[model samples]
Target: MTTAIDSLLQILDLETLEHNLFRGRSPQVGWQRVFGGQVIGQALVAASRTVVEDRQVHSLHGYFMRPGDPSVPIIYEVDRIRDGGSFTTRRVVAVQHGQAIFSMSASFKVPEEGFDHQIGMPEVPMPEDLPSEKEMAARMPDTVPENIRKYWERERPIELRPVDLTHYFSSKALPPKQYVWVRASSALPDDPRIHQCVLAYASDMTLLDTSMFPHGKSVFLPEIQAASLDHAMWFHRPFRADEWLLYAEDSPSAYGALGMNRGLLYNRDGVLVASTAQEGLIRRKKPRE
Candidate 1:
């Protein structure tokens, strides 16, 4: 039986159409727009396939040009920008309906020892102590909004255990910060590339919600239209996606209909494995008569 994780892997596994060209399909999950994380991960995979395995992705920056269409396959066109002795760079553009929807650049490096220091992870309740998403949903079935309930109650490849449940229950304006424990629901193949891409896919999950916190809003609210605008990530160290990792996220500011979010991913052992930043559109839709 194929699990959600398996479906995710299949989605990331782009079909090679030709040299420097690949095709990817979105899961027909009734979403109007393709998930931003999916495009990022697929673009990264497209870039990685062209580079040698000795090198691993160290960082990536991407911009969303338009909302992706879930009805069609996206074509990823990879450009081999440069291949140096120690670093290799590639640019990828995802297209659908004859229009470019996303573009990204990724850098890969051959593993080497380097001076390393990272800010310590914030202390938070262990994932075991936090209520599982399922348990939380079961306990608050009536409290959660219908649209959000549909999304939360479904089986997902990645699982999240939020440090605080207040954000889901209240609309009171609060601090622009959040912490969640995230991990794959099932064991994944022992491939570092797979892990990295999986993490990339999961990074965009809830960071945007931080931005809405100060306004006492949620991206799921119909009155609020939200979408990722741009995303950037840096992988500092190796980590398994199937293991518990703390996702500490915050929004420093939101203005002119945009919100900026930042996140740090730390392994259970408190090793900082990756960091990401994204700015997204969180504009409220005006009501019409």
Candidate 2:
């Protein structure tokens, strides 16, 4: 039941080579040198190793400098920017082919009291009521594509129920916003770190595609080449990733081969738990003669 994407998520384990240098490996998932989310997740895990348990990551910002090569391993060099009593920050540079392919800045903060407020979760069909992405793909197997079918077959760590699957694959132009209910496939442990990491891994799945909704382009479209360029995430409060959460994403702009999208994650109780923004390449191919 596990898909290639699910297996990719599990390969982010980091091995320490020195005080600041870490070693990481990624299996090739076809033509994509490497999935953007994999580097983000691995970089996060490498950063987490340097911080204390009392501190939790509240924000992470990353930029993709170039495509990664899955044929080789990536070396992460973490720079300890600042380690304060209440806050710690790390800069991670992921290197391959003797060059930096990805870089990220992460900030961790100890628990602190602050004003709390969040928008309510929208009312949407439950997972049981809606069909799984795989089921929907089965209806139009062509939409799933052969190159990416392995990704669809992989085990998903997060459950995603598209509010309107038909509108998603159809050529009809539609609104730029999308709503999906997501949560960890299995009940997570008590540790909040695990939940945060799991959420980080799941956040990259379908967010960038929101930008293409108005253009009526499926992410699997063979003619279009999609790649994430940058990613940013902010944690608003402690929340469980295993519980039902609403992910509402919208594309604010797309131009010059780039697409920008933002997302708001709300817990089942209607509390906004996190916010995320990402920009990526959405280059379309010229029609062949």
Candidate 3:
């Protein structure tokens, strides 16, 4: 694995503090608050550790209660709600500074053969045909904003190749839709749970940004205030994070200073492996007095 992926795996590996409790920390990446996806993925890891091996996570719902303190360690407390013959439920709360910052509920189920069907993946150019992150950065060194350029240049665990790059540097109002090819930067362990957690981490990367496409704004913009409020995901099938997957996302509505977006994850073979929905705060900043 690459150093970035190794660091990501290490962060996901929570420390066992006691029964039903684990400790997780954030990378000192110069962010004011912890990334919502990191909390979600770590909380899932905490919940999965309490579940049986046969029971795999099928769905999860989470809410951001408060901004997480990135400089401190988060304490995850898992509650084993119920364990049935086919399904298991676990609740997790992430705490920092002795207060709850995020909470999540996850459902796990045993594998059972059933009728399978999924929406066909949209026709788009393959990741191989798209410009790599470094290439894009080098091509438009002056056009890309400083913050966005820094993000793209960073050695992230997941690599993203967007089908359309116009939204990054342009402010033209367009349809609220986006497609990006995503995959782990390096090979990961064969554990399905790890892949799921990694997918959960990557899912939060750009879903909320789709809502801003119609307004020609982005979370990276300093004048726009954005933060994820709630997030939900459903794992429909097993998939490898190291393999490329298409994240098809669109925003259905944006009102009351909030934007609602949904996404579907399809593997290379056009199999829909997961679905995600999220609502976030997307209010514009007021002029200074």
Candidate 4:
């Protein structure tokens, strides 16, 4: 595995503090707050550890209660809610500084035959047809904003290639829809739970940003405040995180200083593997007197 993927695996590997409790740490990336996806993935890992290997996660719902302190370790406490014949439920709370920073409930089920149906994947350029993250950074024009250039040039565990680049440089209001091809920077182990956790980490990457597309705003803007409030995901089929997947995202509404966005993740062969929904705080900052 590449260093990036290894680092990600390390981040997901939680230490057992006690019965039903796990401790996780963040990478020292100089961020003021921990990444929401990291919390979600780690919380899921904690919940999964308590579940039987025959049961796999099918759905998860999480809420970000407070900004996580990246400088310190997070403690996750899991509750074994229920264990039925075919379904298991777990609730996890991630605590930092003596308070809950995030909470999540995950449900798992044993594999069973079921009717299958999914919406067709949208037609878009494949990952190979788009500019690589490194190439995109290298081709950035001088007029491009520094903050955006920094984001493009940063090395991350997941590589994203947007189908369109207009929104990156322009503030023009556009449709609240976007498509990005994403995948882990390196191969991962053959564990399905690991793949699911990694995908959960990547799910939060760009979903909330789609909410700002119609307003021609971004979380990076100094005058705009954006943070995820709640996140939900449903795993539909098995998939590998190291393979390219299309993240088709759109915002359905933005009102009352909040935005709601949803996404469908499809593999290269057009099979829908997962779906996500999120609501985020998106308030514009007032000018100082």
Q: What pairs collide in candidate 4?
A: none
Each candidate's TM vs. the true structure?
0.99, 0.90, 0.98, 0.98
**Model 4 whole-model lDDT (C-alpha atoms):** 0.95
Poorly placed runs, candidate 3 (over 4 Å)? none
Q: In angstroms, how far off is 197's CA in candidate 4?
A: 0.2
Residue 251: error of model 3 in Å?
0.2
Ten-residue stretch with the least lDDT total in model 2: 3-12
lDDT of 4 at 45: 98
lDDT of each: 0.95, 0.83, 0.95, 0.95
Over 4 Å off, model 4 = none
Model 4's TM-score against the true structure: 0.98
Cα RMSD to native, each candidate? 0.8, 2.6, 1.0, 1.0
Q: How close to the true structure is residue 256 of candidate 2, measured as C-alpha lDDT? A: 95
Deviation in Å, model 3, residue 30 alpha carbon: 1.0
Model 3 clash tally, residue pairs: 0
160: Cα error in model 3, Å: 0.6
Give the Å error, residue 186, model 1: 0.8
Query: Per-residue alpha-carbon lDDT of model 3 for 1-289, expressed as tens digits?
Result: 3488898899899999999999999998888999898999999999999999999999999999999998999999999999999999999999998999999999999999999888999999999999888888998999999788888888899999999998899899989999999999999999999999999999999999999999989888999999999999999988999999999999999999999999999998899999999999999999899
Tens digit of per-residue lDDT, candidate 1, span 1-289: 9899999999999999999999999999998999999999999999999999999999999999999999999999999999999999999999998999999999999999879899999999999999888788788899987666667789899999999977777899989999999999899999899999999999999999999998889987889999999999999999999999999999999999999999999999999999999999999999998
